[model samples]
Target: MAVTSNKQGAAMQLCMALPENFRRQDFLAFHRRDADQLSEHVTEDSLLKGVVWQGQPACLSLFFTERNVSVTLDADTAWSADGQRTLEAWVGHMLGLTQPVAHFEQRFAADPVVGSLLQRQAGLRVPQSASAFEAVAWAIIGQQISVSVAIAVRRKLIQHASLLHASGLYCHPDAQTVAGMDEEQLKALGFSRSKAVALLGVARNEELVALLAQPVATAEQAEAVSSRLLAVKGIGPWTVSYALLRGFGWLDGSLHGDVAVRRNLQQLLQRPEKLSDKETAEWLRAFSPWRALMAAHLWAQQSSAGY
Candidate 1:
């Protein structure tokens, strides 16, 4: 990818070329729903408010075209050599730019269901959270709840705990911020007692966050991280798997107990009832190393059909 950096007075802008098959609309679909909480959508640009290393607040407005993505930041500090590298890494992670899309497409070419889904929604990517801590917190908050309600509660938590950037955008709260929040305040914002305690438990344990933040380039590495996360209270298989997929970008990960996955599977397989855990595991294994991307495709399929 080609990167160009330019400074216009106080504003810093960087442009990077996307992959050959990158589709901006497909990437935006995954993030558009959370616009109110972590980002703002204006026309074709998605404005991301985030904090860099050492808790430096930064705002990035991403504009996408067929071949490239342009990021305009409000602060000049983020344009420095080190800052630019950090920003590029973060953007690549968020957009799943490093994923082996061609390999997955080749693997799914003969599969009936995933192949059909891929044909319908080409160049779809699994969008990730800005931070692993945020992914874990959202996983806990979403347990046994609908997506809409989880988003509502998350927005409330952000409003209460996050700081506003100088650019007038709200940055997502770090683990430290959530750890310091009162349980009563979180409960008032619609967090269950268990979820509140779980969030705090994750936040207070710096080691857990560090472990979750580790790079998982192989199945064994991903499983090690999953096992460590499972040791945390209130974190289950579903949560760990989901976190591995969304937080660590583990391609082999699958949300085995996900309701949406089960529902989508039932609909796709023409089953009268929800698939059992064993059955879900068997079906998900069909995609093997690309199960996470398969899950994203299922979600995109359902969303497009207005399910």
Candidate 2:
């Protein structure tokens, strides 16, 4: 087992939520529950460990495989409290795993047809993750980069986002802070023009502010609310879908266009021919909500293949 510590500091009261609609075992299974690669995260300061962000009141969500559940942010340090945290882990789990049709029929409701379809197919789903501010920030840092490289960039971005001490872990930057950052600063940090532009543009978008203003509940409304994010300048189908899975708690979204996903699917399908978008869509359709889980499973496989 790994020791646990918070980089930001001691926390306020943490209200952890794991929705009844979501299954913890199903969710962990999707991520493979692989501790070797995920251990550093037990300490909040590690690059590959937790997901940190600065919203109205600066929050952090860290994943500790040592404990089978993804823990809520311990917001203590300089960060104060809001009212209550909204996890919708159930919704996130819905979007993160791939399951059999029968299994999903039992778990997810039918009001959202696509989500239900996905649930029936995929066992789990990945949540959309962060709001636009955090999504674009992460997306920019991760663009055209390897996992290690992206993790390094995230470290720098987090450093730029706040005043770090104690253990050198910092909160993700606020939109205003990032908005004021110059392209030259980003360039000096090896950020590509496209990535810098996208990140900065996100920092300036008023819609990001609007999103921050809202209370994040779950993916119950993702099928409708996702469109608002998709309309953003830097956001696209993949980005929105990513957010829906991690952020909005989308249960059934898949990223067929993703390079990693495409490569992984190629290995999984082992078809006579290369996969087209249409064919990929068809092939992935069977996985539905579990497509995200399949994705995680495939990612772990691909990642281990190199070793």
Candidate 3:
């Protein structure tokens, strides 16, 4: 991946190539699903989001076209050459540009259920968050709640713990920021006491996030990450799977525990009722190494079906 950067005053401007299969519409649509729409902003052909950059609050903007993207970082100080490259790579990862899904399309073209989705939603990649901690926190917040409600709680948490960028966008709180808050504070923000404890536990666990951020290239590696996450109190299979998918762009995490996944599976299979989570897990095992992508297809199918 080639990157070019220019520092103009307080902003770092960058130009990076987009993958051929990159679907701008899908990317924007995926982010637009964020019910909160607080820290992240999405437009027809661009994205603007606040993130903790180099341990400081910053806002990154990306204007997308067919073949390439232009990025602007709003920060207090100009980034060094290395920082610029790191930021560029992070932006690429966050946009899912770093993930190649052609193999998935090729491998599943003959699959009856997913083949059609692959054709319909070609170029779809799991969009990642700014950090693993952010993804984990979202997973915790979203557990057993409606997306809108979870988003509202998340917005409140951001307002309580986050800093605003010059662009007036609030940066999602980093682990240190969230960890510093008392459990009662998070609970006051609508987090259940259990969730508050879990979030705080994960946030204070500095090494866990670092371990999860590493590239997961194999089943063994993914399992190791899962083991570490599961060992944490209040972290479960669904939470770990979601964090892996949305945080590390890991493609194989089984999402059978997801309600929407099971509901869509019931519809797709023409069943009278949604499959139990255990049944869904069994069915999803057939698509190992691509279950998460299959889950993505099911989610897209749900949206298209107006479910």
Candidate 4:
């Protein structure tokens, strides 16, 4: 919780700290997937654009140090205490500030592959999207498609549907905005009809939104939420698992049938073939409650050395 304030007339600047073991470079690297998409919104200096609080948009620059992360805001912005709190919560969710890594460290202390990864990437946290809606939207958009294609489609959707902030940044569209989009509009953006329908369905489901809005504090609670999400028309086990990990910040589950996870596991074990889904699950169970973190570490294997 690194929050500082300075006032000059009507202008204010605020700063916040990165949590323990958190590395700014690692975070930025993880989000830097494509130059044409959301990753572009995160700049080299770690200045993130289109941060919306209470429906107002602002640009935030994050400066990293050995001990803390400092946040600087636009000079004209004056955030209230409540607004600041909201911003803090949003940053926490995005950076995984509240996630504990000690359990994982202890659990993997004697293991080989995961232990090495845990040691190598001590402060690496599983970053989440700004909101559950954004996470679910991304899941639906990414279903059965290559990551690059999904990002392209998502960028198109954002270009068309997102709100442009006065700061020249675009805020991701909410459920209502996406739900209002017609099938042809989505198809033009490369969304399959089924995916478009699922996106619209999720956006229109108030009950689902309300359910995700509640705090998920335990594995059981997260599982229940996953069950409800799976009940939706196009939401599958993989999507629900992904939403739980990335949207709800649950550390209890992994991307159960993800090919990347299997590939990573196979590579870690020095196996000639990818692990079967059952084998992946059985092996991943060793990570237990922190399997999501394990998945993040596995994902990091293909990423830059920042981890």
User: Global lDDT of each model?
Assistant: 0.74, 0.49, 0.82, 0.72
Deviation from native of the Cα of residue 282 in model 2, angstroms: 2.9
Task: List the candidate 4 regions with Cα displacement exceeding 4 Å.
Answer: 6-13, 37-40, 56-60, 72-81, 304-307
By the TM-score metric, which is better: model 3 or model 4?
3
- The true-versus-predicted C-alpha distance at residue 144 of model 2, in Å, is 3.4
lDDT of 3 by residue, 1-307 (tens): 6678888888888899888778776667666766567888988899899888767889889898888899998888756768787778788888777665788788888988768878878887777777877888989999999977987898899899768888888988988888799988998999999899899888888787677567676788889888988888888999999988888888888899999999989998889976999999888888778888778878877562111
Error of 1 at 218 (Å): 2.2
Question: Which candidate leads the pack in TM-score?
Answer: 3
Models ranked on lDDT = 3, 1, 4, 2
TM-score of each: 0.90, 0.61, 0.93, 0.88
RMSD of each: 2.5, 7.7, 2.2, 2.9
* Ranking, TM-score, top scorer first: 3, 1, 4, 2
- Please give the RMSD of candidate 2 to the true structure: 7.7
- The local distance difference test score of model 3 is 0.82
What is the Å distance of residue 99 in model 1 from its true position? 0.8
Candidate closer to the true structure by TM-score (higher is better), 1 or 3: 3
Write the residue-wise lDDT of candidate 2 on 1-307 in tens digits: 1122233345432323333344433433332323333212323221122334343333344342322334445444354333222333322333332223346545444534344434543433243333545654665566556756766665566656554423343445667878889888877676777677767766677775566435344455554445665555555666655554444443456766667777766766565666776766676677665555445444544552110
